[model samples]
Target chain A: MKYAATDLDHFSESTLHTIPLIEAKHLNLSFGKQQVLENVSLNIHPKEIVTLIGPNGAGKSTLLKILLGLLTPDSGKVVRKRHLNVGFMPQKIQIDPTLPMTVERFLQLGLKIQKRGFFRREYSTTNLEKYVDELNIGYLLKQPIQQVSGGEMQRILLARALLREPDLLVLDEPVQGVDLQGQTELYQYLNQLRHREGYGILMVSHDLHIVMKHTDEVLCLNRHMCCSGHPHSVSQSKEFQDLFGEHTEAIAVYEHHHDEATCDHSHGHNHIHLDETGESKHND
Target chain B: MIEMTQFLVFALLGGIGLALISAPLGVFMVWQRQSYFGATLAHSALLGISLGLLLQTDLTITVIVVSMVIAWGIFTLSHSKQLSSDTLLGILAHSSLALGLVLISLQNSVQIDIMGYLFGDILSITKTDLWLIAFTGVLILLFYWRHWRDLLNITLNPQLAQVEGTAVKTVQLQYILLLAFMIALSMKIVGILLITSLLIIPPAAARRISDTPEKMLLISMLIGLLSVLGGLFASYHFDLPPGASIVLAATAFFAILQLKKAPM
Candidate 1:
């Protein structure tokens, strides 16, 4: 559970060659005078879906922003492979209903508009229509952005991000405001993309169950990382246990050791506990 | 009555340029909800005009220089952590306007036509004014053309824009410079008093009709052009101020569009 610093360093170094997509060394971050992240080192690989999971104010969003190159760390080397196109789906900001914009127009923006110059590159209306169709929101292409549902907007954004065929996708709470069905559908679509394209996905999410089921890896962050590995292992580790507490029945079942005596575990339960003499002990 | 030919020609050129430039930029401003900022910038043009009068320089050059200075000042002041943006904009907008008024008052011998400048005189637009307007129009077109994607990216999401290798500060600089030019040149047609309306109204009207930003901009320009021509005709026929008539025309267009039953 408590891997030594040297062990982590060794693991990081050895894994660097095989699947290194992003590597950060001795990262230190601060907002004004307050230190937010300290002596953090992490590596993310290609085709890996890393979820930054933590409680509120655990610096999950901050670390994600840093990874996206939105914020600069005070002391760190964030080495990314050259020309790595990163597609970002930010947390939904409040959009005014009166403002008029369509899904098709929005998707066209994601294409490399800067390459040809602004307003100079004339977008084919047919091509934009095709891209919006590919997003499965062809029906919503003509609707006002303000009029669309949150789930629909998220899809439109997803379509926009995918238009460029990015190398890496950075999503911050992609399913934050969507309904249950919408969330499921989005994840299914994302999973399909992951399987097909092998693009790296780093998502910051609080939906533990879905993330546990869907993601390839989990990066448990609490200012400092508690663990980063397979979700099943990371969730069962002492750090996760200590942080989330031994509350969930499934996790408790996983954490319980067969060699330990079962007497103390039945403190508040209605079930019986037996001693070595096979005599029942009842608190009531 | 004013000559119809002169009115049509001047209004067409000025109105088209103003509409095209402002509609796109205004959408950006409105999206960012920087209407107050736009108002402040427009108000600061008075100071630029006054500075031009005081320096005995080309009016367009003087206005451009003064507005750019005010814009740079505002940008610099806003960047400081101490002052809030609203407080800064309020102080700068009023202070510049007041300073411009006082300076103009002090220059008694120059015999400046303050009313004409404020209300606009389309008939009075000389060839020099036309040339300046044309040059500014081309500059704005080129500038926006080159940086359109970057501008949209920053407007949509500043943090994401930074991540995507956009030089946000530099883009912002370019945007402000273009805005200054637009405001300075627009003063000849719409006048400083009504310039912000021209910048904002057409876009607002067009947005109600179009679902896409590109279409919105185009529609806004069309609406603006119609208002300018209609206002000019009305002004010539009915003996009214061109600026006031143009603004009223735009407002009427907005009202008519609102009265339509179907949602855009």
Candidate 2:
């Protein structure tokens, strides 16, 4: 638990005192006869990153859709602060080949739709170049969106989401196609954005090791709220170990050497050894 | 000779109007992979034709209304999860068309040229059809001008669009209704059977040559206009069916463009 407390680190401690950017209260949903989500609730405050991790079909996406107001929960509701602008990055988007759209045009499309209410002043206009350069997607701008590689597509999508200049960013598997090295860079970048802009980030991810180091809260879901707490505690919890099995040990180690603010520290070669074990378990 | 000249002018104007509106709409249909949806709408339009004839009402209005209703029906039924959309579309398309044919055959006193409805009589375009196409073209342009970004956002991903504050359902419903109106208006020039061809071929041809959505829309419109002009000329000289001639001309463009491989 010993870690350096920087000026940026104070926000994590003070987040609970400030009103949440978005809050979900005892949400429940079902599709026909099957219950999809049950009594799930979570809060996302500014300068905080909450990662939702779950097994396949664990209602992770369902919860996100509810949080975004894309789907109405059968019971319970999501509350957002007035004029809260949300930037969403979906898992993957399949653009029809017949629709010829360049990456730059895709980013620009985000700027075209005027968000409802008066809260879009912060994002202003024409942040497309800023995000494109930051995400390192400048070279892919003129290329057709459909032609981009998977990793490039992820960055392009992230850039598009960032162009919205949202107060809260909801990313679903934001680093899906990115390599291990790119994943760390993206997490570092997101951490920077959170600290610099005081924005709240809610992401769904399966990359427990990388995400664990960066996220303030981890909501482990399996059609219900299995566990919710700091990533370190959640990884050690019985529910997490039961759900994720052998991967918890590696994540716990990954979480220890890393602190929220610093990204330059080494993970030690022993951590890589654990990552292979986690991957091999995944194959089984 | 003057009457012939007037007939050609009206046909050209009406054909050009339809082509202009079809470009943006057809490009979307192709992009959304809903080409079958357009065909389904056109097929059910025959039911509207039969109803209009049976009720002795204005055929165009009734056809437009029925097309809208069918389009709405398709939109709602697509959520049922009972069958794949293509299967559902196929069932609705042929059944409504069959019902229209059955209803038309039941009428003993009225004499109608079934071939004219099936293939179209573009050379016999009246002033009323021209006005309706012009009005629809205006409406399509206005709607698209305001909602182009929204529509493109939705096409990229509806959930993402919804999150970004675009009313996905409302925008989608409006687009579908406009598609119905366009299909109804196009029936007179292309006929119910060939209407989808007019709505699909130009966009498909344009895809080979254009590198952006806006460019595709523009190229499709140009291709559509050319098809109308070339088809009219060929039909005038060779005494061929204008609707079929127009579709063939579009197909020719699509074939010729395919020879130049599009850059990946």
Candidate 3:
């Protein structure tokens, strides 16, 4: 279905009214007998970057998979306002060296290829080439998918997804296994795409610090959605504190340390003091 | 000496059709990592051929019916919780091959060229064979034309395809039917033992040089046609077996393409 330009404006209005682009209600997912996601409810707004974060075995990826239609939840209702053309960038895909596909070719596969009545149109290679250029992956277009570096591969996948001009982009750890520079570049490009295209993004990531800075909302999912709202609010929620006790404390300490370093002041002498035997005291 | 015009016509029709059907089907097989599935299906064709011979029926009809049955049966059984696809395919592949061998062996009176059929007998292809191949090719082409998008979607991601309103299971059945048709017809040209090579090798070879799926498929068809024609000609001159020679030609082309500079 063709999406009109006004659709973005309508979507933005809906979000203002607290109507989600996608709403998952009372979702229950189980693999065999073990429950993965239990009564998880999530609402994602349009043109907003929502980050799904949790500890290992926290069903972050499972929730993303269910949303992307990769996994069918055992019981729940997922409501969507529009037919979402979802562009998914899965966690790292291992390309066999024997596979002789290029990045441009990979991207074109996502496009709908149709034969006209009685006459077939000559295949055009330029459309995807232009997309590769737009995604800043021109050099990667000709290279074998197997030979490209992880960051380059991620870019190529992003370009492939973007070529569809999808309404929503779902990324499962898009920056996982990439270096810091690569992660930064990917985030920058994603931000640019969202601003220009107004496509909604739902990203599942373990890198909380990076996501906390760029995302519009944070969904802390541990079996069920523990909290949902602004990153700062979720991070400070009691549920988050209870679920990630020591880890959350460590993050708070690190943030405080970083803030103190940036502000050029000794903020808290009590929390950072010398212990017996000349050892530095730290909160556990 | 072989008639140049007749050989060219044979190569053009047979090669092009084989290539067209295999290219798309092969891409799915590779994507699913189901190369073994093709081999199993090809092996099962021997049972079809054997049944045809025993019943004194038309080879094409017998082979198609038998292959489709086995394919459908395997498809059904694989769906059951009792038997996995790997286990079922292994059982069927070996049993059919063994049964065909035994049944053919029992007939001590008739002198059939078993090796030629096993390897390939491209030179011995009759007018009826050509007609069957051409008609089956059209059917496959029509099928592919109707479900091109659905096929690609399922190949890339089945779950997504299902969610996007495509009948994933129905598409899968159509794929198996198309593959069965291709394998059944290809057996007469490449032989049951070597049919999967024609289905898989050309696509694998073309994958190195082409970028898009369509281009890769076109290149694969061209490669298959060239290999078939070149191998037939080479076998005629060198007194080699046509099937072995064609497979060798394809292998050589694969090696050269791999050694050549990467595609731009």
Specify the highest-DockQ model's number: 2
TM-score of 3: 0.75
lDDT of 3: 0.70
Clashing pairs in 3: none
TM-score (C-alpha) between model 1 and the true structure = 0.80
- Cα deviation at B78, candidate 2, in Å, is 2.6
Ranking by lDDT: 2, 3, 1
Candidate 1 lDDT by residue in tens digits, B139-221: 77777777877777677767767766678888888787778777877775568756787777887777667766667778888
* Model 2 agreement with the true structure over A78-185: per-residue lDDT tens digits: 899999999888999999988888888888887734444332322246787788888889898889889999889988888877887889999999888676677777
Off by over 4 Å in 2: A1-11, A112-124, A257-284, B79-83, B110-113
By lDDT, the best candidate is 2
TM-score of the first chain alone, every candidate:
0.76, 0.84, 0.76
Model 2 TM-score, 2 decimals: 0.91
lDDT of 1 at A193: 69
User: Could you tell me every candidate's TM-score relative to the true structure?
Assistant: 0.80, 0.91, 0.75
